[model samples]
Target: MVSISDYGDFYKMAKRNIMLAILGFNAQKHFCDTRERMVSNVLSSLHKLVAVDPHSPLNFREVYTTELFGLSLIQNLGEDVCSVYVEEFGREISKEEIFHVLVHEILSCVVEPDWRDYFPYLSWLPNKSFETIVSSTEFRRDAVMNALIKRQKERIARGEARISYIDFLLEAKNSTQLTDHQLMLLLAESIAAAVDTVLEWLYREIREVCGGKAVTEEDLPRLPYLDAVLHETLRLHSPVPVLPTRFVHDDTTLAGYDVPAGTQVMINVFGCHMDEEAWESPGEWSPERFLGEGFKLADRYKTLAFGAGRRTCAGSQQAVSIACVAIARFVQELQWTLREGDGDKEDTMQYTALKLHPLHVHLKPRGS
Candidate 1:
């Protein structure tokens, strides 16, 4: 029941150290070296879905893409960072388990209100129902995480000699003064946190740019329009609609009238992205606004979808790379059109923004 401010310097230090390990140049290069295999596996899984009956409509919803994306991401992250292998799609039970624990169990608990948060003095008051639910969810989450750590430890005992984030944590356990439970939570947070599109114009762009060859990571730099499409999409449908709460250490005025030292603040990410003052016709889906010479890769952060500053997403660059390559490859191989009824569903938010209803779409091979 610790409040947001309860985290101490050691916690922050451990997180900083872990983030540096995961996001450093060599770690990023490892991710890059494995990108081709990851993308290939995803595309292969996708092909399986649409290739069935070839002309039939596919649901092509978030769940489907999530599977493709999650499996690929977990496979790379697990292999490179955890020394574990997540099965490919179809046999991707591990990926599904990870998502279930992360999105359903943990995220559900996150949005649940706790009486203690608003009234610390009432912390002793009985909260049996909430406590029961949270406890159950935590048990389930810890089960999954503990299993991964246990497997990693066995690898270490076997003298596998693999370098991974988990190995780093294990080695630093004594130096960091991190208890087993603390290490488990740190690994859980890392695993949980370590967790499209305009078609028509982009199809033409790919055809012109790649000339019928598949889009590769190298070609991403040349696809500025594709970059705009991604930026606009992120602006409209941010990764997280409301970021985690922040604790104010000193009194300060914010937006005219906020002056309290102990106040807890939260950013309404969706509101900021849709701010009329900042973006022209903010509700409109206009990729062209991001085009021309003003466009820079750094501009992708302008929406703050991945957060801003040092606390920004550690996997942001890796995220962009995977997304650009995936989108390009999809358009290069298939024709995509939204199903009639799905075109109007508003985006919904849980922990991340998602469609109120799953997106349904029709797809066909390009030559067909």
Candidate 2:
């Protein structure tokens, strides 16, 4: 029974930023009202997209995640609708720029080869190909994100009430000294993380659980399997495999290794998750292993998809809610299968992430 009203910071963030980001500040209630309703519409859109291409092998996975899911998240963050209201795209800029960031910036940065990562002293050595890709990704990401922020500014200036997470960030700027760059990056990452992980979530497991019937939020309580599947998804294919860099506060020893203060450490979360000492059959997707374990998923909860410690995702609850809605509705509506003859093709592991490469699926309408 987590009421939206219970989130006090949400109210404060919206209140402070709404006037600068948008006009007329009674947007808190509007945000709460649309939170669930927007998801319902998104679910409807996904079904419609699948319906349009039935009987043919379709890349419904790509369409749902890249087009529908990304669009839906943008709308939730602070837009009138999924349609890009502002005519900001040019020949140089892509309409799907955010998707480009997910694929190129985040995914490519992690998966691609770069010896500099191992030997920090060789960082100046050239990697022309990846550097070019990164340049393009950054340009597009910044352009699109800036345009979005500008649109919100215009909407608020005209006194149109638009309550969104971006507005919350605006509100925090005055009190918390949150910079505009920080705000836009926050919104951008939120879109990327929310859409990408749900795209890679265990759809097959979900299909098995829901049985081709659309799963409403009400039905979620009865479907513990959905939760377990999500848990296993994080365990096996954590979206953020390597954590952000961290610094040691004081000299210490860990696992019999000595560490000194001022050392910059990059934790290998993926390696920890796959270690055999903690997980039995660590490579396999096994949701049932968590059952009857009484929440002892592991001694230390090695999963680090959203990160760990005090810097763990602030919007974790909201992210999980979105994931649940997407998974339940998706599993309920479509009969999904891997593309023919590609059953043996496992998810591809990139330097930064592990996900299905060009995910293609044959989606048949449930009950048809």
Query: How much lDDT does candidate 2 score?
Result: 0.59
lDDT of 2 by residue, 66-139 (tens): 44444445444555333333344563433464455544575566455666778888888898887876777666
Q: Which ten residues in a row have the lowest lDDT in candidate 1?
A: 82-91
User: Superposing all C-alpha atoms, what RMSD in Å does each candidate have to the true structure?
Assistant: 4.9, 7.2
Span of ten consecutive residues with least summed lDDT in model 2: 1-10
List lDDT for all candidates, in order.
0.70, 0.59
Q: List the residue pairs that clash in candidate 1.
A: none
Model 1's TM-score against the true structure? 0.84
What TM-score does candidate 2 reach? Answer: 0.72
